[model samples]
Target: MRILITAGGTSEKIDDVRAITNHSSGKLGKAIAEAFSAEGATIDYITTKQALHPDNDEATIHLIESTADLAAKLNELMTAHRYTAVIHSMAVSDFTPESSVTIEDLQDTIAAKPDDLALALKEKVRERTEKKISSDTDHLVIVLKKNPKVIQQIKQLQPETILVGFKLLVDVPMIQLLDVAKASMEKNDADFILANDLAEISGEKHHGYLINRHHKVKEAQTKSEIAQLIKQEVLKLEEAK
Candidate 1:
């Protein structure tokens, strides 16, 4: 079997040196990747630095730093490779700065000034923003482009691929989880969704729930245990085929 797993939160740059990101530890995605590797499947991982899975000779890892990069890489791989499954586990940053900074571009401006590069960088960004507004071009508007939500897009590429999406809730009711999972499955076109109360399970050394297409739910406390559940489900799907 071949699988693709996306992990970690994207980092959106704020300036030449600053960025905005998330608190995702990427534990879930890493565990899924490792589990698949252990199952003797070829695994490919896309992740940021927030979570690091032990390197496996059988698996290939690709580092994705930002939301745009994540989308591009996924599209590239999905088009080029035929995988049996794709797991969308990454806590992909929902938003990124519309404008990214390049230190090299600011190098000349900073060199001409005695001031810290931060000021020069800010000025450069401001100039760019003003220039965009002056041009009266909607394309230049400093608004974030929605990154491709992976699960749905992967299903579009290969509908038969066993696509799974992760839905994290906090302190919500069980019924709520089911509802959210159902919506997520439909919205993302996932075969299944792992819904769990991160508040209740995370940092507690405990469990999560797997909500399948049938709307049936099962619980597994440890991430490794959850991996097993995923494995069984994916294998079952393959067998059915």
Candidate 2:
């Protein structure tokens, strides 16, 4: 069996020195990769640079930083190789900095003796051009825009691959969580969806549910247990195929 897994949180640049990202440790994805590798599957572990990964020599690792970087790597790998399954556990950023204005630009405009500082500042809000904003100012405002739904593109890229998605909620009821997970599964055409709550994850004991198309659900209490459950589901998918 061959498997591809994405783990960790994708960072979106806010400025040259700052980014917006999640707190995912990538431990679960790494564990799943190791479990599959132990079962004789070749694993391609694509992860963010900040994610925690295993030192196991059996799995090949690809490191990425930003959401664009992740998307490019995924496109390249999916086009280049065939995999039995894809586990997309990466917490992709929902919003990215649409445009960034440098403090220096506004200062320059202010120094130009414009009648209104507000109008000059508004006029200076041009499209993003530079990779890094100057750090000459003490404060800055960054405009944000919604990022593309990268997970929705997976099935389109590889119609036959088994895709697993994750839906995380914060302090929500189990029923609502399940409903959201089901919706996500349908929308992404994913074979399985892992649903979990942030409140539960913060505790010493973590809990999550694995929901499949057949309405079958498996519960796991720990990251390792969830990894095992995912591996079992992968095997089931392989057998069915």
Candidate 3:
């Protein structure tokens, strides 16, 4: 079977030198790719510049930095190739910088128009985005806008592909984690989702629960095991077909 896998954290640029990103190592994604490769499945890996990747010579790789770049690349690839499955493991940012302004300027606007709070910023505040923000300002306020859910776009592009999503929550209880994962899976129309706890992940100690549309769940304790379980599930599905 042919498969597409995305790994690592996408970086949103704040300036030429700064960015908004996460701590995802992309180890699990690499492991998953290797697992599928060993089974003789074709792999297309989309990832970032710094994340870990599989050394397999046969797997094709695509690089992306920002969320927008990922969307564009996915559009191009998904349209060009017919993938049998897709595993989205990338840690995408939820918000992106809309604008940035000095705290002093914001305060000045509030002071000038004390009566109407919303009108003050709407009329006086001038948003700016320099190639490199000046360090002269003692403080700055950055307005962020919510990003579109990239995972939801996968099934829309390829409805028949076995879409597998990953949900990572930090310090949440098991019940809450699964519930959130289920909701996200249903919303994205994913065939399977792997719910994992950030607090529970540490080297080989990583724990994950893979749940399907029928609510059938399988447990795995490490990145390797997770890859194996996913491969097994996908093979079963391919065989059943």
Task: Please identify which of the two predictions, 1 or 2, would achieve the higher lDDT against the true structure.
Answer: 2
For every model in order, what is the number of clashing pairs?
A: 2, 0, 0
Of 1 and 3, the candidate ranking higher by TM-score: 3
Q: Each candidate's root-mean-square deviation in Å?
A: 9.2, 4.7, 2.7
Query: Which pairs, if any, clash in model 2?
Result: none
Higher-lDDT candidate among 1 and 3?
3
Question: Where does candidate 3 have its weakest 10-residue lDDT segment?
Answer: 121-130
Please give, for residues 5-63, the per-residue lDDT of candidate 1 as tens digits: 88877788755555778667777677777788888998888888667654758568888
Best by TM-score: 3
TM-score of 2: 0.85
Question: Where does candidate 1 clash, by residue pair?
Answer: 206-221, 207-221
State the C-alpha lDDT per candidate. Answer: 0.75, 0.85, 0.86
Show model 1 residue runs off by greater than 4 Å. Answer: 99-148
lDDT of 2 by residue, 1-241 (tens): 7889999998887766888887798888888888888899988888877888866586788999887888888898899889899999998888887655666666677689999765555557654455677656787766567777889878989999999999999999999999999999999899999999989885336699999998689999988899999999989878987
Poorest stretch of ten by lDDT in candidate 2: 121-130
Instruction: Give lDDT: candidate 3, residue 134.
Output: 70
Give the 10-residue window scoring lowest on summed lDDT in candidate 1: 132-141
